[model samples]
Target: MDEVSPEETPSQKVPPWLFRAILTGAVALGGLYVLGWLIAELKMLIVIVLVSFFLSFALEPAVNRMERLGIRRGVGTGIMFLALLAAVGLFLWAIGTVLADQIGDFADDAPGYINDIEDWLEDTFDIEVDAQGLLDEFQEGGAVANLATRLADNLINLGATVLQVLFQILTIALFTFYLVAEGPKLRRNICSLLPAERQRQVLSIWNLAIDKTGGYIYSRLILAVISFLAHWLVFWLVGAPFPVPMAMWVGLISQFVPVIGTYIAGALPVIIGLLDQPSTGLAMLIAIVVYQQVENYLLQPKVTAHTMEIHVTVAFGSVIVGSLLLGAVGAVLALPAAATIQAFLASYLERHEVVQELEDAEAAQHPEREPLGDRLRQMLDRVFTPK
Candidate 1:
């Protein structure tokens, strides 16, 4: 007659097996937590290893071709790294010399440009703008002063970022060199540690990744060259300074770097174009915009679909996810990673029609409870029906 507590009920008893199970689960969860913490600590190293792997995949085709041409693998690796270093050095040198000069020239020429803009505005729109006055107001309002104060802060932040990036690049270069030079031996060593079936599977996956990564890089290189030529023509015609280097910068960055690279690549050329004339700058901007639109909406999708055999939508999504996980390097690596994953899954997952996972839950919640007579009637109808 007394109210029974659920905890005291016979079915509610904690058996020795259940207790052991709970303890085991708790210990497992704790171990997982520790593992997660350790991984977080090693995240930078993990990113470098992954990026290095991706780069090695991308460059392996060139190394193989060099070998086929009678070059030793070590020499081929050296040649690849040397080329990479030359490009990086050029980029750095251009940034230091050209960019620094441009900034100073910009500061000197800004007032003249402002006057020309004001004169044009007055002539065209009857808007007698005081651009110089506006700039003076901004200066007086502590805006320029604020910029001066923050310049040091920005420089410090930038230096730290550059060092971090250089470190990552160095790690990737070292790993890529080793992978290119000793790939066959490395594969043999790795395979020796695994069983025969696992070794075969690992090699298969590795080969697939290399193929996709090589294809991705090749496609990008082709596009980059086209972009470079197109921009070079534009820059030469417009009389922008350093047309060759500027075009190379735009082409490589816009083609290879993800998301915001287009704007960064286009900015210098556009600014230099403006130094030639406002119309030239506007033309440059328009051309860059149109080209980017074509690349994003047409060229990129077609190339990726053909080369990596990945849908544009999947490639775009993977880039977003990868960028969120590991910033720019992740975005660059994501497409090939997605392709590799698709290839790997295709080897294992069954081909079947899919159903929603929640369907069983819904069916359980809304069970069809029928009367015994109704069930009998249904059974009788089924029995009487033709097979």
Candidate 2:
């Protein structure tokens, strides 16, 4: 027989299941890519929602109190918003007034300031310098002209930015209002989708978030007040101009803003101090540094422990992590978010008493140190007890 040609080898075929699996995996990967893109596009919207959600939680306690007093939730929310706006308006007015007055005073006394500076330079550095000549040269050298030109060029941009900020604020307000006013209904609808156990867990988490956010807000307010008082006293003693506004600026910015806020808040006062007198600036700087140390080491830990039930170190680390992830908003929200997480974890995680040997080993490592609980209690006692 002629060399039988082997039957043409049939091509190996992929199993149907394997082909389907590959197709499914490709689609899944494509879907994931699309999802990531969408998330990137909506990042700002997501952040706005988060901020509004937390704001609603922070205001819920006050709204509930108002509801108990026979106020409708809508009315209470509106009232709260109105009050917030009024407070903001009042602050702006006060700050504007202070600044305008200072500017006017400085204008009137410019010549005197120049003379004083000249005398100081002469006395301190023995440099016979004509300060007025330098001032004239500065005005004539096109520096001031360039500054004005730049401001003029960017005026439209500035205006647009302001409008954008206002729009965002309005959006946040609307979201917050709805969340607060319909909080109960929202909770009910959420619970409707879950089983009884899950509903309880959801509700518990909601309540926990509210408590933590509210606690964070209240504690920060308390700290702000303390900062204001301390700075106001220091400013007055040092005869710094606009002491009230300066103190308010420091207090609110330092307490409410996160990360670099303290530096920003302290800058204006120090700058003004330097302009008025170097010695005054030095004093203010020293006071600010001392106050920060005291707050960081003493006041912050105690207050946060009682209110947020968070350790300072954990709060700080959260802030850093939050800032890395979401910038300023993350930093601002870090404390409450951390507190809620910690509380939730504490409830779910099982606990066991430490073994005696481990305790003994720890004690041995720090033989002279008291138990952490005891040390904290003693510190609190010292702080709160009257002389």
Candidate 3:
């Protein structure tokens, strides 16, 4: 190696403090980037934990009832968990079986259904259309084949996603058990984390969250039951095929999906009916529309009011936002979130003196601000005295 000149030496090239400062900045940036990624990746787990906590709270009433009947807390909790698991398993099996059968039937009759739809569209719109030509074009090119291949690939991907979800669900269940088991201690620990003055406020907020979540869950359960019965009766009376399974699916999915739930619930039955007969499809569609109106106008407000009194607009907006962010899980979560936010805002407005005074003044004078006492006195004096 050649000897370096003193001026060109690496040790003389940079200040130690400057180099250290640059290194520190780079390391800090890297650390922060890594932390952000970790948080994003772990968001799903955080959601799962939150959901589990809400479920645990919702089941508290039942657990307490069991305790009152002389069951131990642990035993009652175990029974509740088991019952939940069994119900879920049964529901999944039913839905899976129905969906599989329906998919197979749909596949078998797809060509005929396509032709029927094209004919109906042409007749209804008074426009001639060629269904066979379209099908031929689709088949002649590689597009149809590629689409089928992609569909198969998508099915595999869906299966993998389902398996992953199942794994996550098991993990959630395990975490939920621990959360429920140590609920009291966990609450105490949470309270301890705050200053003495803040502890009470924190505890009160916790209780409110629990109460709202529990009420929402209970209300949803009741709504699901009522929807199932209503749909079942309607479908049976209308002579719809697969009435029971369709009704059950409608009820369960509607409970989870908000606003457009009824529309989505009706899609399957209408499609199946169209495959068989146009008149029957129309009848089924009418039945769905009527039932949805009844539910929306009458049942929903009454049922929800009894639980958590969230406004319809708020509920709709929350579900839309939540679904945009987190899909089905978010939709399920949105109701409680809206209720909680509404409660907080209401409480805040109630506690604020300025807000209270403004509200009172507004009530007394429509679309006008009343004068303050001092201003009113000054006005009165000006009017009485020669100004």
**lDDT (tens digit, per residue) of candidate 3 on 1-387:** 998788786674566699889999999999999998998999888788877877777777777788889998788889989999897787788777877887767655666766877989988997677777756634535455366677887997889999999988988888777777667788899888889879987776777777788888888888888888988898788777777877787887777667777678788878776665677788888987887788879988898888888877888889989888778778878888778778867776756356788888987888655669878998889999884
Cα deviation at 334, candidate 3, in Å, is: 2.1
Leading candidate by lDDT: 2
At residue 338, candidate 2 shows an lDDT of 95
Best by TM-score: 2
lDDT of candidates 1 onward, in order: 0.83, 0.88, 0.79
- The 10-residue segment of model 1 with minimum total lDDT is 137-146
Query: Which scores better on TM-score, 2 or 3?
Result: 2
TM-score pick, better of 1 and 2: 2
TM-score for all predictions? Answer: 0.75, 0.82, 0.72
**Backbone clash total, candidate 2:** 0
State the lDDT of candidate 1 residue by residue for 327-355, as single tens digits.
88799988889988998899778897657
Superposition error at 25 for model 3 (Å): 12
